[model samples]
Target chain A: LAKTTQPISMDSYEGQEVNITCSHNNIATNDYITWYQQFPSQGPRFIIQGYKTKVTNEVASLFIPADRKSSTLSLPRVSLSDTAVYYCLLNAGNNRKLIWGLGTSLAVNP
Target chain B: EAGVAQSPRYKIIEKRQSVAFWCNPISGHATLYWYQQILGQGPKLLIQFQNNGVVDDSQLPKDRFSAERLKGVDSTLKIQPAKLEDSAVYLCASSPGTSGSPDTQYFGPGTRLTVL
Candidate 1:
C-alpha cells in the first residue's frame, strides 16, 4: 500500500478553479489514482480517476504526470456547495484495497 | 436505480455496550465495503466482502468489530463492548466487481455512531 500526502486545507472563491494535488512517492506499477469528495455527514463520492496523462468527466478532471508520483484534481467553476473534503487514493493490484489519507479539505467561499 | 441503503442513520451507545448497523448494497453489485470515518479524517476501510465471502479484513478489530454479508445482499456490522474511540460514521459502499482494475463505488448516506 502506498501512502499519499495532500494539503490539509485550501480556500477558493466561488467561480474560481481549485486544484488539489496528492503525492504518492511509493506508488506501485499497477496503481491507479482515484479521487473522492465528501460533504459534511455524507459518504465520499467518486470524482475522477486516471492512470497517466489526463482524464476528464462532467464533474471534474484528473491529471497525472509521467512519473506517476503525483496527481492533481481540478474542479472548475467552484461554488459554495463545492466545499468538501477531497481524498486521493491509490488502487493497488487486484483493486482489493484502497489506502486513504487525511485528504484535502477545500472551502469555497462566496 | 436505488443506491446503497443503510438503516438506523444515527446510533448513540455507551462504552461497553453493543450496537449493530445494517446496509443494503445496490442491485447487481457484487462487492460490499465497510468503512469507518472519524471527524475531520478520511474513511478507513474496515472490511470488504465479495458476494458473501470475506476478501479483506486486516483493518477490522476482530475482537470488537464484526461484519457479515449474508445471502450476498444486505449486510450487518456489529460492535461488542464499544469504546469511546469507536465513535465515527460507518459508511457502506458497493462496486460492480471488476477484475484487474478498481471499480467505481456507490456509497450510502452512512450511519453515524456516537459512543459515550
Candidate 2:
C-alpha cells in the first residue's frame, strides 16, 4: 500500500475554485488515483478517478502528471454545500490494500 | 438502483457489552467490505469479502470483532466485550468482483457505535 499525504484543512469562499493536491511519492505504476468526498456523518462518495492526464466528470476533475507521483482534485465554482473532507486513494496492486489517510478538509464559506 | 443499506444508524453501549451491525449490499454486488472510521480519521478497512468467502481480514481484531456475509448479500458485524476504542462508525461498501474492472464501490450510511 502506498501512503498519501494531503492538507489537513483548506478554506475557500463560495464561488471560488478549490484545488486539493495529494502527494503519493511511492505510488506504483499499476496504481490508480481516486478521489472521494465525505461529509460529516456520511459515507465517502466518489468524486473522480484517473490514471494519467486529465479526467473530467460532472462533479470534479482530476489532474495527474506523467510521473504519477501526485494528483490534484479541482472543484469548480464550489458552493457552501460542497464543503467536505476529500480523500485521495491509491490501490497499489491486487494483493495490496486500500490505505486511508487524514484527508483534506475543505470548508467553503459564503 | 438501491444503494447499500446498513441498519441501526446509531448504537450506544457500555464496555464489555456486545453489539451487532447489519448491512445489505446493492443488488448483484459480489464483493463487500467493512470499514471502521474513527473520529477525524479516514476509514480503515476491517475486512473484505468476495461473496461469502473472506478475502482479507488483516486489520480486523478477530478476538473481539467478527463479521459474516452468510448469503453473500446481507452482512452482520458483531463486537463482543466492546471496549472504549470500539467507538467508531462502521461502514459497509460493495463493488463488482473482478480485477481491472471499472466497478466503483457504493457505500451505505454507516452505523455509528459509541462505546463508553
Candidate 1 collision pairs:
none
TM-score for each prediction? 0.97, 0.97
Across residues A1-110, which tens digit of lDDT does each residue of candidate 1 receive? 58899999999999999999999999988888989998998898988888999999998999999999999999999999999999998986344768778899999998
lDDT of 1: 0.91
Q: How much is A47 displaced in model 2, in angstroms?
A: 0.8
Clashes of each: 0, 0
lDDT per residue (tens digit) for residues A1-110 in model 2 = 58899999999999999999999999987888888899999999888888899999998899999999999999999999999999998864332388889899999999
lDDT of 2 by residue, B1-116 (tens): 89999999999999999999999999998899999999999999999998999999999999999999998989999999899999999999998776774456778999999999
What candidate 1 gets wrong by more than 4 Å, as runs, is none
Real contacts recovered, all predictions? 0.77, 0.48
Deviation of model 2 at A95, angstroms: 9.0
Indicate the residue-level lDDT of A38 in model 2: 93
